[model samples]
Target: MVFRSQRLSWPLRKGLSSVRVKARAKRRLFGRMLAMKPGMKGSLIVVVEDDDSIRSSIAEILEMEGYCVNAYPNGLAATEALKRTEEPCLILLDWMMPVMGGEAFLKARAELSESNQRVPVVVLSAVSERAQGQPGVKSCLGKPVDLNRLLETVEKLCLSGKCA
Candidate 1:
């Protein structure tokens, strides 16, 4: 007897939406050339996001673009990692998370040595408005994040030496 293979329906299939597809394509088109500037390669970036997929995706993208990325599931883990690693050029932080949120993280970050305290942070949150004027936060971008804007912000900060 021969077995037949079955295809999943649209609803059952996993795939990206048109907007996401377009965004990804656009990112691929420009991610390499626009991601880093001269002398920016190997600069580290810390990503603190509770969502696994988002964290991994951001890390993968940044790594492909020649920056070193350290991703953690929450603020606590990221803070711990920060203590052990060389200072990152920038930090992309999420607002809400278990085991430590962005606000608390900022407070903790402020208490670290002066250099650590000065590392630029870009808050990614639904409530980005609340992050404005927060110490060490250079910028805030709302979620779901715009890939273009995110890349632009990273490039600007890292290239301009503002993040250091």
Candidate 2:
């Protein structure tokens, strides 16, 4: 019995037009409860990225992988959504943005949050400074973010319920 993450199961459906593949993927995702990505039926991912292309691309990739992802133009939007504490099992936040950059947003969130204070955040940015010795961030990806690494972090944090 091979235990795989749900993120792997969803993408298999795209290339595989066969009924067997779809069934197998569904079975794999449901049966392997221990390796499930989120707490509920669908996991939501929040991405605070100013770059439209990068944000869309990343969101599309995660969505294809079966995770429900939301992209924000800046931290404020993502932060507002975070207050609801509904979507996004994890957050992929960019270090730089026009208003309320990642650092400020993070600080504000920490200060204001009564609960959901430990939301996992992965710093996806072109700047290396944010990644180096940055506090309260789970992971960091340099510019031209690596898709594999991003997915890995998402899967790990979403599953474990803690930022690395």
Candidate 3:
């Protein structure tokens, strides 16, 4: 009985280990990057999302495309980061988040001084609602957003300097 139990457990343990290895590899590929340090240009982009995997993937993708990325887990954290930058920023905002939702961020952002208010926010949410009319929102992207569309929107906004 002991030998039989050991054999069964061996296979299960092997399978579990393989799964763990794969997950770790995926994270290593897309989850490790340095945050934009102080004195770095504020013209860089800011990604605000609650999901760790989603935020890491987006930050990795954008960074691979040569964009400087600063990812935050919530709107409040991103807002605090925004206050420290001297230059205008491009923001990719998630609608639902703890510690201040995207809507509140937009409102608070609008109330900020002119320098901070210049940051253009692009909403990224699973819902299909448009964000065109929202204060400080330049556009909206339905999630699981397409990489091409995301890049295009960023380029258009970042290159043209048009957030209003």
Candidate 4:
């Protein structure tokens, strides 16, 4: 698993239509591209979701794959954490939560200092419409997210060392 770090290739950036091809590519490319900072092992991934099971599952999966994860029950908690940590390499953000929704968090994140503003974000939501055209959001994943798809997207975004 490559640390979610770089701009994806064109086909991947547009979205990989061929799962078999992507899987093959993931297998072939992942080893060569594990580019996390030395001693860090993996880049940081922030997950904000109100659903405890969903948040825990995502965090567990990411951790199993070697990424450092911080899971939050709401955007407000995540925002506070992000402010203190290194600009995360990637954020897996859910659309709705009690204290602060993803939109508010995105807006708040953008308003943070220059470095914070550049952090890459991927929106995960049940409402497809609400997930579109979100400023600073690199991609969207529908709820009941396919684990493979989520992994692929994470690899595409993070493996290349291009994340802010």
How does each model score on lDDT? Answer: 0.80, 0.70, 0.71, 0.74
Model 4 misplaced regions, further than 4 Å:
1-41
Which ranges of candidate 1 are over 4 A from the true structure?
1-38, 162-164
Against the hidden reference, what TM-scores do the models get? 0.76, 0.71, 0.69, 0.73
CA RMSD of each candidate after superposition:
8.5, 6.7, 10.8, 8.7
Q: How much is 44 displaced in model 1, in angstroms?
A: 0.2
Total backbone clashes of candidate 1, pairs 3 or more residues apart or in separate chains: 0
What is the Cα-based lDDT of residue 108 in candidate 2?
77
Instruction: List pairs with backbone clashes in candidate 4.
Output: 3-158, 4-158, 5-158, 5-162, 5-163, 6-162
Q: On lDDT, who's better, 1 or 4? A: 1
Looking at model 3, residue 108 earns an lDDT score of 79
Cα-based lDDT at residue 99, candidate 3 = 95
lDDT (10s digit) by residue, model 1, range 1-164:
21111211112125666456446655764675576465575688999999887788788667756678999999999888888788888999999999999999999888777888878999999999998999989999998777668889998888877443
**Clash number for each model:** 0, 1, 0, 6
Candidate 3 lDDT over residue span 22-73, tens digit each? 4654555344434432433224788999988778878765665556788999
lDDT of 4 at 87: 73
lDDT of 4 at 12: 37
Q: Say which candidate scores most in TM-score.
A: 1
Give the range of the ten consecutive residues with the poorest summed lDDT in model 2.
Answer: 1-10
